[model samples]
Target: MDPCTYKRYHKHDQDSRQYLDHYFSDKSQMVFGEDALIFPIKSLTNAFAAGHIKGDILLDISHGSLVHHLYSACEFFKHMIVLKIKDRCILELKRWTDKRTGAFHWGHAAKHHADIEGKSHQLEDKEVKVRSAMQHVVKCDLEKENMTKPIVLPPADCIISTLLLEAISKDQDDYIRYLRKFSRLLKPGGHFMLLGCLGETYYTVGRDKFHAFSYSDDFVRKALEGEGFIIDHCKLQKRTAVSDLTDYKAVIFIAAHNKK
Candidate 1:
């Protein structure tokens, strides 16, 4: 199914809301893995705090689940930019790729794709340039589209984006594009922070699931370097036996800006 439909299905109506409450409260395999968006931001906040991160400027990508956590974490920031892009762009959908090797792969996960189960899909792309400019690094027009070249951004003291890029990239190039899309965010003398699923795959809504792409730590590092984020610190965020779900951890990246 497309993202619009998936978003509709995920709407917190009274009935679906009831299911979420029960699902989150469950002490079994089902609930623990099901709830990812909520935990990553909380975990990321604590991780940044663990490093004693406090600054006067901040930027966040993917505004959905991370909104509350970011607002709470960056109280010192005089400016904060929250970004929301396609979780899975219906217009820019691409096939899955290998997490480590960046190779194309497909599977017959028929049990999951009840809707759009056998439909032809296209590769999706996000404007990494436009996205990079959105985070208060500089003043760029959000009203325009189809930019010819990337614009520059002001160096921020700290930047945070969560669970983005991984979901939008259908192939390695797309992943690189997603990373390059954010290249301009870090200015000289700036810092960076990102939290994403290390090997996250599959998205299920009320019993409907779909195949998803996840990136490895190596892939993430390469993409960051490709985008000008030189890695200064990296951490394995959390490994919880909180439930029986496969152990998926958030890889946190803290890089320093080297650009003049």
Candidate 2:
């Protein structure tokens, strides 16, 4: 596939519903349920529960309108500010957050969170916590020097971005450039958690193929190091699902703290 033929995420009209159904629906048998959903949920829950990441403010810059990863995080942070690049994604998230009539049902994801914490009975409460913690959803543009631009945000105690860098970046330079932008959002010594795929070139969503920047674990470590972040914990899960929706060799989770 030609690089120029790949659809640009920010410039295209993405079907948010199709994205949710393809990857996050309870009945769907896609690999995301195992690799993307379960892995991040378990990893984040464990990280938060162990007190590895705790703060008053958390800035989340994730791809799509997904909220499964924030279930565990809501409990640890007093406030969460989500930055989205697309209005469609923002609307999709608001549907769930505002509890609208046709909101996407994330009950299964909530249950998974509760099940892991052994609080199956409080499944309903889990979603409430996530909604409550998400205080703001702001629009962002990665190309801007200050992604959020005119609306300056307070430096966060921790910043978490899941599968967003690769989705938005067209190449390694773009990836590193965006990484620097993300790093600027955190305070000195603040933690940063990143979740992304390894060796992925493309992912399809609702009949549209989006480019994914391919990078290795070593490259990521060096990237963080170059940005003055101290590596703390890193985990890699080998791909186990058979699907044509995406071509990812593995999923990686890295937790680090900025030195500056």
Candidate 3:
């Protein structure tokens, strides 16, 4: 399925209760492994907090509304721009950042991130920081040459995406094409961080199923290298058990830099 249809299937916060509960809840660790979302969040937090990666602007390209992946890393950048495929997703994110009524509670994820940083008691503080760092939540069309058209954005120091390409690409070729489009939004030597589900073809948002690209570490490595990125980090975390919700074999996280 293309991004537009995929966007219709995708929901965030309250609308994505089923998706969040099935894939991101703490209980998922018993079936999907502890590192499903933990590894990427903690790793990015550690890297940025330690000065291993430095950046002034960070852009998050995600299918639905997802701020969990940006919580920790947002602290490292002065501005955070979120590019979403649908206006609904953008609105959901804006509700949270704008502190609107009935906003989905991200306290759980924020608390988890804070605990990882050895500040378990500062959940509220972390939430505030994440919200403050979220400077923009904009609409984007992935299939277009300029994803964020009409309003030009400065080249980002880092571009981060999670499970975005997998849900949008029809095959490896499409994945590469989308990857190159993302690269164009980054400055030279800028970092690209991605999280993907390995060997995944379909995932559920509510009652509907969405397509995801099936990929391996080798496929990903070759793709990034072929696009002129220098590999900085690569890791694959195997699943503990299989779930009917998805057919992913493992969770993969990669960090690479655009060649200067």
TM-score against truth, every candidate: 0.53, 0.96, 0.89
Which lDDT tens digits does candidate 2 get at residues 1-260? 67568786777777888888887888746557888788998888887877868889999999899899899998888999999999998998999999999999999899899999999999988988999999599999888888888999999999999988988888888888899989999999999999999999888887798888889999999999999999888999999778888898999999899999
Question: Which candidate would rank higher by lDDT, 1 or 2?
Answer: 2
Candidate 3 local lDDT, 1-260, one digit each (tens): 44345432333222444555566665624354355557777767765675756678999997567778888786688888988877767777788889999676667678778888889888888888888889688887776787778879899999998888887788899899999999899998999988888988777666666767789999999999999999888878886656676778888888889996
Off by over 4 Å in 1: 1-54, 86-155, 237-260
| Candidate 2, pairs of clashing residues | none
The whole-model lDDT of each prediction reads 0.44, 0.89, 0.78
Candidate 2 lDDT score relative to the true structure? 0.89
**Mind sharing the TM-score for model 1?**
0.53
lDDT of 1 at 150: 62
Q: Which is better, 2 or 3, measured by TM-score?
A: 2
Most lDDT-accurate candidate: 2
Candidate that scores best on TM-score: 2
